[model samples]
Target: MQEIKERFKELRKELKLNQSEFGKRLAVSKDVISNIEIGRVQPKTLLIDAICDTFKVNKDWLVNGSGNMFNDSKENVELEELLYKISKENSSLYPTVLKLSQLDSESLVLIDSLLDKILKK
Candidate 1:
């Protein structure tokens, strides 16, 4: 079994969250996240449950590294669900959504900046 602290750090990194952001989601201070990541403190069951519930993390993976990180089927289906919903309710928006999904990361950033400017106007 992996050490819980190391697993926690891995989970946070995989989620692309910095300590402060991760801690905010867990209702803990950044210092608490730092301590947990560095093995200075062992998380109690409450915190463990919070992590699993809040992020849809697989408890087995977080605790024992035994399974996929995200256990919830909803996580896996999010994009598909979004596309389906948009196609069903907003046919005009569905093509745009598909185009956005296919954008490269750099192009996506440029699009985001353009969208921000347009939204601010």
Candidate 2:
């Protein structure tokens, strides 16, 4: 089993973020990040989520050290990070999208087509 220090070092480096900068994204102090990296602290669930999402880390791997650290490429990781941030602010978006999907095939296709068009432009 990897110690917290080794896991922390690998994760931060894989994300290409400095500890202080990563801490800022997770809304934690640098000292908190330092403590986690050096085995002085065990991060809570919320903090773990923040860190994992911000760095595109695999949650299971972080917790148990059993899988790849990151599951996405650099660009995809950044996009996922952005989406996670948006998720926090727009908690209703998922429910709204789900409701919209329950309408009809035509409505779903229309929405999907519209999104595709916008994405292509």
Candidate 3:
């Protein structure tokens, strides 16, 4: 299992937040964050949930290191789940989705416009 203190430190660093700033986001004092990070005290469940939700962290990964570090937004998670199901049903589509995932936002917008035009025909 992942140590909460270690994961808290990692999350703080990843977000480029100092203890004070991180604590502000969680509505806690800097001392509280410092204490949690140092293993001086366990954070409350509300604090843990706040950390996960506010930072888009995977609760399982934060708690047990059992999955991806970040959780996608609801829309993204839904889309990904749909794609996974589709990919399983039609394996060839998986590569296309993989390639699409590599495209930057601008490129994706261009592709979307082109696809819209094609579909309109």
Candidate 4:
């Protein structure tokens, strides 16, 4: 419980978001976030799911602090961080990156195959 509160604060910091901003991203109020962080309130499952989806946070780590913070492979995390940096440096790429992120695994594999063929040519 205390660990969850502490990790909640840590996750918000890792995302570079203030409580208000983090709450806005989660469609929650700042007070709600603050309460959860202070262990005055427990987050609901829906909020937890939203947190995981919006920030690519790991459910297990967020719930129990049992694993890596991000819900991604190491390589994927590196790539995501790179893309995040790029989006910050070049805002124009943000939309493209967002669209790319919405692709399913099969679509990603197809894109990867196409890119590999192009690179090999």
Q: Which structure among the candidates has the greatest lDDT? A: 4
Each candidate structure's TM-score, on Cα atoms with residue i matched to residue i, is: 0.60, 0.59, 0.58, 0.63
Q: How many backbone clashes does candidate 4 have?
A: 0
For residue 57, what is the lDDT in candidate 1? Answer: 81
Report how far residue 35 has shifted in candidate 2, in Å.
0.6
lDDT of 4 at 90: 100
User: Per-residue error at 108 for model 2, in Å?
Assistant: 22
Candidate 3 has its poorest 10 consecutive residues by lDDT at 73-82
Best by TM-score: 4
lDDT of 2 by residue, 1-121 (tens): 7876788778778766788977887888889889988888888899878767667678888888877787677788866666656667898776875587488988889989999999999
Q: Residues 9-111, candidate 4: write the lDDT tens digits.
A: 9988876779998898789999999999999999999999998886788999999989789876656745765786798789999998788789999999999
Better of 2 and 4 by lDDT: 4
lDDT of each: 0.84, 0.79, 0.83, 0.87
- By TM-score, the candidates rank as 4, 1, 2, 3
Q: What lDDT is reached at residue 2 by model 3? A: 61
Clashes of each: 0, 0, 0, 0
Q: Which runs of model 1 end up more than 4 angstroms from their true locations?
A: 73-121
